[model samples]
Target chain A: MALLEARAELDVIVWPEDRACERSWLMENVVGATGVIVMFPEKVNTELLDKAGPSLKVVSTVSVGYEHIDLKAAAQHNLKVGYTPDVLTDAVADLSVMLALMAGRNGGIGVDLVQKGQWPNFSWSPFALCGPQLSTTAASQTRKIGFLGFGRIAQATLARLVPFGITHCLYSSNPSSPPNYARDAALAKQHNLRAVSKVDIDELARESDVLFVLAPGGSGTYHVVNEAVLKKMKRTSILVNASRGTLVDSDALAKALREGWIWGAGLDVVEGEPNVTIDHPLVKEPRCVILPHIGSATLETRGEMTTRAAQNVIAAILGEEMPSQVDLSTVL
Target chain B: MALLEARAELDVIVWPEDRACERSWLMENVVGATGVIVMFPEKVNTELLDKAGPSLKVVSTVSVGYEHIDLKAAAQHNLKVGYTPDVLTDAVADLSVMLALMAGRNGGIGVDLVQKGQWPNFSWSPFALCGPQLSTTAASQTRKIGFLGFGRIAQATLARLVPFGITHCLYSSNPSSPPNYARDAALAKQHNLRAVSKVDIDELARESDVLFVLAPGGSGTYHVVNEAVLKKMKRTSILVNASRGTLVDSDALAKALREGWIWGAGLDVVEGEPNVTIDHPLVKEPRCVILPHIGSATLETRGEMTTRAAQNVIAAILGEEMPSQVDLSTVL
Candidate 1:
């Protein structure tokens, strides 16, 4: 607010409510605007750009994911785009680990059982309500963690898993990328992990006691974790999707969970999320824990993202370089 | 099953079902029995000992907690008792961290809201569901983890927190126990923690960003985390109880949560548990995530505990030292 207040001549309009702005209101108000800031829900498409006409110099979003924003449209209009990326890495990574733990430990089931007043009827059995342990102990000598995509959030999550006696780290990323033995060796030594190496999807599924899907969302990566991929995962393994939901087939995962192909799942993003109902296949599964796209919902991270988005708009309007500008050429 | 099969020469009665053994049947069938192995629910008191008569040589429980066993009565009856320990440490410790993360990140509320079909009604606001991040991210540099007791489970939990960039560790144990600076310093150095020191209850309450109660259950520690301590804690702090439910006063905690004295709590055990209902004070709080007592409810841990318990029974019956004999003098 102070930054905007400094320029008294500038006019600003914000959505009146805490909710995402209505599409019609945004299109109407965006006209004659020099800059606009939005979030995941507000689509920056050709229609919005055309509505803004030539006055809109930039569109900055308070989110890391830009699949909602049509970069091809922005490119056609020769518009600069800014996104908050690394600022929310820690928050998303933390939520990733939280999901992993929740899935592995059956946290959702535990809470639900208690909430329904069924706890009093449950008996203390030797193996009842049991799930996989996330840490290495006397019974388990080694713990292995796998990532579908070895990106910033995945690595951050790996860093958090080191002290849990994680012995191996397996990741399946872009196979075309060259192997870097030196980097892998350094990471292994730093975390005292026995090995840190890239693996194929099959091996990643077979070995990971907990597999985290942290890949980007796109048609190319859609359903990367389908029935075939899930079948290879250890029956004791847990699957966590803290990234885009499209990377995993919800129907396949729900079937896998029901048939005991995989032990459980924790998902932040679902295929048709924000519209997921109580009867959703994944939500109906006893072992699957679902959250409504809250991977970056932390006070500190959200505030930082908002600040960064505002800064990007202010910079773009003044013809200054954005701190975290999205390269349209690559995105397009 | 194989282990017990080998000892078929000895008369043994097995519970026919996977569920808890019928109480009336146990009391009647235990007559003239040389040994008995039970779990948390069975009370090994004066009545049980009297019923077993002089034939009962040992009573073994498939749990680390012996609060249900009356050691004084067992001593009078000249019966050796065994309790499983160490086997479930890793499982409980893992759950402790899981609870802490769930409480800090609002996992329970997030899942519940999604399951209730409320997400579509909710808006995507910057700070709608924001809570504290468990890991030391760009927004948070130092994470302080506190423990009510510095015993095995607490230390195991501390080990897990190290990878999450925990900077400080504070614990409060029996005041009579002398501080072991050398051991604490070594732990600090090993985990790259800034400091690891024992503190008073007041300091623990005031300083911890996440407070875990891993102390043993009994009258001495009952309600240790009362209203005063809750008031001293930071509003953003999280409280986790993986030990015993009695450690926290449920009514006080309910009021604290309702009035926003602290952020939230994750409880695996509750006072008068197995009796917790939907209208229970703690369960009624949205911020409090309650689980039926399931700290050691892992397949590996529970199986190990049962095997250990059986071994104790077999050894005691064979005129050999028990594998995990409880020192009656100390316990009494």
Candidate 2:
């Protein structure tokens, strides 16, 4: 609606109303187009660019991830790309913490028992329905939080845990970059944490009471949480993935839950999500709490993302610099 | 198990194994018993005191709420009562925050959609499955957190929300007690909040983005969140009850959800819970996420509670000061 209202002198075309725009419809409509907006389901490659007939100036997506867009081809086609990033960091970070709480507290199992009409017959005992406590208790005075990626969202999550009496923090980032000890010390001081250090993936898995997977998704980062990492994690620890599906191996997670290798898992994105069925291995596991890829599904965040995408397109069409234009060279 | 281990020379009578000891069995075995340990299901009353025949010196309950116990009767009978309070505070506070997050987001609805194998058929749109975000977003800068009771647990919960960028706080405590402006100012300064003040139930409902019920359970607080108060709430607000079922009216909440008086609810305790079935109004409402009275259900917290109960009973039996002896006068 914002895009439609903002298009003053320009003619705007929409792929006939559906859940998503079909590729054939987009291909047939892209001829001589000045700007295009796409979602995760659409691919922007050489073929789509060729169909646009060298007249296309901008491609804007209302998402933080641009994996669906072929950045190398876009650079070759001399196109400007825009994506909504920082706007969604808080929304996704909030979901990440919520998933951690759900997974650690047997939320899915409890909901099932109530929905199945079994709660009436369920008996309460001192230890019934007990799970590992997420907050620091007198019995467990120290807590360690670990992150697979220590980017903006991950840091936001760590900041939230500070009030939960978390004692230490450990994270793993891109190994290609050197550890920033100065930055780590500064963050520890800012948060009043006992320690904040970077470590290898295995150490992170072993020491963390809750391990969060917030790394980007792609072949290079795929299956980072595999059988070996799952096995190395504490038996009482929880796993939370809110970033992307492919970062975690579904089979490995299923097997881990079956054998009690780890306590539980909470996932917002799954390996083949939106196609996940009741028969899915993780779905069958009572402790695995799954959401339908709604990490950034907050009305405020989505509105901002759509409005930003529209601004990017409008600015490019007016021959002004796009607000959030992506440097395709760096992406490639 | 802790009680058994600690009882050195005392004759410990065990009830024939069951989920809960029957009243008949307890009456039959409690004859001339010097000390009694009970859970939520067991009521320590005048008749039970008569059954014990002046030998009862202590009645220790492994819970924070002792509504089942007759405090006035215990005071008349010259009995020392013990209840675990501070030990479970962190655990309950953690769950309170979890409930708020789950309710503000569409956690229960999302889980149902996924579990029913409807995700594949469900189409993703920009605003689909969108709910009000729990955290402060750029679009919505200020957030107000409200509490039904601003006691220890409620204050702990408020501490956890500080990192979520919550700006203001409003809480309604006991009307009999005057507002403590000094304490509220100190708390506001400590949390870096814009303001912290007392408000009436209606104003709290209207202004809070999320309202948490953390008051004690009794006739005094019963139905405090009835239809009139629910009607005053924001359509985008959420209601979370981790305190007691009686604080909220189940039928009224169901109707509120059905009519969109509030966005959603996450309840750990429903009115007449454990008896809640699929036919129950709140259980049947997709927006109401119910958990079966597991606010203090953590292995660490429960273990601490049991141990504390044991210590209290043993201390009273040995004529020593019980660690958590309840003043029946104050309770009454």
Candidate 3:
């Protein structure tokens, strides 16, 4: 909505309805398009690339996660791929925090009570609906945040979390770029935190108060948060994932939530997600908050993403440097 | 729940199923009740006071608004009264901010699309679902904010809004107290905002980008936000109410929403609220976000309130001075 509203004057844009459907008119329109804007669900693979022809300059997508789009295909066609990333971290991270708060505070029951008109003018007694509170008070002693992946959006998301009483952060990444330890330490120190990189997922899961998954998608880290990792977490710990649908095992997470393996879970993504149902193991649970993949849905973020994507496509066609290009080697 | 858990040793507590129930019972172990806790709905008038039978020196209730309690009756019986106040301001203020954000960003539609499965992945189009963005940069100007009543909670809410890029603030109070122009100006200056009290309800309604209702409940201020106020606001303006359900005229607000008289309304409180339904006019409207009176529903806030209420009762009975005493004279 933000992108459309922001760039309404565009002469031409390429958008396909679904992955499998490619109408001749849609392909023809793309061939004549001076600019192109695609989304996460729509695959811009070789067929679409061939359809796009030579006029295509930019390929703007409204997603932080670019798993659906083929960067290799775009690179072959000398097409620029534009993706929306850093802009969405705040909105997504804020929602993540909201989810954690809701899960810990019995948000489902509260919303139900209101809908049922069971709210009393004043409640009596203790621990009636007491869940958890997040704060950086001395009483909390040690607090550390864990992220499954370290990237630009994850870093920005961590920055927001720091002001809200997090004392340290532990992250597990693929140890690329020689582990830039000094820069990482400086970043953590800037936020009065100790930034540590864990070699093992168990250490990261067990030691951290809250675990956030911002790791990349696919088999490399698929189901990284399996039963063992969940079991290793402190009883009062929380798990948050705003990255991708395949990172955590939904069944294991459901069991963990039902059996109190962990205190609560806040997932913006889940296994077999967005075909998400009320019957989905995590969906029906009160302790889990399920969003319909709105990580980059904020107006500011989406608009910026669309504009950048458009610019990338334009730069690629004009043979200029693409603003944001994914590593083709990582493609499936 | 916090209070009840805190005093787990004290088992017996009065609980009415609803507002009209008057059934009372005495448990076998009633001899050990060191304190009594009651709210306005329980009718702490003479009969219940006499029935309490002198063993109770302290009575505390969990609320900042204490219109239901009779202070004179408490004083006559030599019973100490305690109520929760300042502790809940932040929670209510946070809800106020949430309401404002939800309304401005078209959250109602967002929820509906996700619920109905109308939203497709990474969707973008010309004018799809654009709404106001809170962040401000050098190129973007801050939005204007106004308050219908400026109290401690309102001040706290204003502080939260500051980070969301609010440039100015205006408030309109009752016909009395003659508007503390200098004080309001000083407060606005403190926050680097252009705070003005010169505006009447009409001017505020017309000029404010966002208008907040932070007044008290009941007859004198009933439906203070009528059709007149709604008519004055900009076509893109939003209204937020977290104070009392009786402050806004639901029919007028509903009609305004239906007519798009204003952009949207975020209501934590509704007139004759909690009785709201999907069939309700406002609920049927596209731009209205009606929350079920969750102004101070956060677990942290509710727990602290319960604890404070208990502490208030304990202190007053022990003759150590009630920590939170209601200003009974303020009640209408």
Candidate 4:
């Protein structure tokens, strides 16, 4: 709200909705705004850009993922787009590991058993609630960790995995960057890892004891961990998606869990989330630990994200370099 | 089962009951056995040891903790006690970190929000269900991690915390051991810790952003983390108990969680567990994430523990050195 107060020098209009900003209100308001700040719900498309009438210089979003933003439209209008990124990396990575452990260790089902008042029905058994151990032990044979996209979030996650005695690391990045074995070996040494290397999707699926989905959302990465990839995964493996819901096909994951293709899944996001109700397939799966799309819901992370977004909008309006301007050339 | 089968020549009378071996049944069966392989439920006392007459040389338990074994009685009878130790360390450590993340990130409440269908009732607000993050972010203040007792499990848990950007470390061991500044300094440097030192219970309680209770269970440790210690904890701190239920006072913890003495608690073990039913005060607390006593429930860990117990029994029966024999000289 301070950002809105700061914009009183310029004729600035703020969306007055308690919920997500209304499409019609955004459309009408864009007619004369020099700067606009939004979140995940708003879509910056050509129609909105056209309505701005050349007055709009910047669109700042208070979120890390910008798949909802129409990059092509922003590029066409020569608009500087800014989104919060690194501020949220730690919070998201923390949640990602939480999901991995929850799924692998039967956290959701165990809690449900306690919450539903069914714990006293039986005595403690040796194998009750037992699942694959996440940490390496004296008895452990292999400890392999994998990632769908080896970016900042994935690397942060890998750093967490090092002290757990994770031996091998495998990941797949975007097709543009070729494998750099030397660089990866250096990274491995830095983290005291056995090995860290790029691998193809199939190898990543088959070898990973725990596979994390940390890719961006959009057509390029949508449903990347679908039926085929799910099938290739070890039966003891766990799938965690803290990146975006679109990266993992929920239906495929549900079926895989039910059929024992993988041991379990921990998901923070679902495709078309908020709309994903109690009746959703992933929600109903006993093994799937589903959160309500709160990967960066930490107070510190959210506060930083909002402050950065406001600053980016302020900078863009003042004809200064935006703090975190999205590179539209590669994205579009 | 294979371990039991391996002892073809010994007159090993295995407990045939699927449930916890009844006290009456155990008393009847120990009449002629030279050794007994028991679990947490069985009490090794004067009565059972008396029943076994002079034949009982050893009581091997398939658990890491021997709280159930009446140490005084065993020591009085000159009985050798063997327990499975190091094998289950990783399993417990894995669960400890899981509980820390779960409590700090509101994994329990988030899962319930989905299962209870309350997610659709409200819009995604900026701070909905957000608790203190487990990992130290770039914006994080001094991240202090504390341990009530610095044992193997606690040290293993600390290793997991290293990559989470933990800055300070504090721990309290048994009062008898003198603090070695030089050794502590070396350890601090080895783990890249900002500081690591043995502190008193009061300082440990007050300083830790995330406090872990990994002390042994006994009268000395019972209610060690009581209301006073809970009160000293930071309002944003989290308490994790992966060691013993008795180490934490359940009533005090439930009160702390309700009154917001600290942020939240992740408890894998609770006082009078298995009996910690649906209506238990700790279970009912929204901030308390409770799990049944399954800290060492991983299939691999459990198998190794059982094998070790059997091996201890075999070693004791043959008058050989036990694999993980308890130092009864000190216990007595």
Candidate 1: residue A48 lDDT (0-100): 92
Cα lDDT listed for each candidate = 0.89, 0.90, 0.67, 0.87
Superposition-based RMSD of candidate 3 using all C-alpha atoms, in angstroms: 5.3
> Cα deviation of B331 in candidate 2 (Å)?
6.4
Please give the lDDT score at residue A274 for candidate 2.
77
Greater-TM-score candidate between 1 and 3: 1
Q: Which 10 successive residues of model 3 chain A have the least lDDT summed?
A: A12-21
lDDT of 3 by residue, B186-244 (tens): 87787677555646888889888889899878677888899998988888788999888
In model 4, state the lDDT of residue B109: 91
Q: Score the docking of each candidate (DockQ).
A: 0.72, 0.78, 0.19, 0.63
Per-model TM-score versus the true fold: 0.97, 0.97, 0.79, 0.95
Ranking by TM-score: 1, 2, 4, 3
- Model 1 residue runs over 4 Å out of place are none
Candidate 2 vs candidate 4, DockQ winner: 2
Which tens-of-lDDT digit does each residue in A199-243 have in candidate 2? Answer: 999999999999999988988899999999999999999999999
Name the runs in model 2 displaced over 4 angstroms: A15-18, A330-332, B15-18, B330-332
**Residue B177 lDDT (model 3):** 65
How many clashing pairs per prediction, in order?
0, 0, 16, 0
The DockQ score of candidate 3 comes to: 0.19
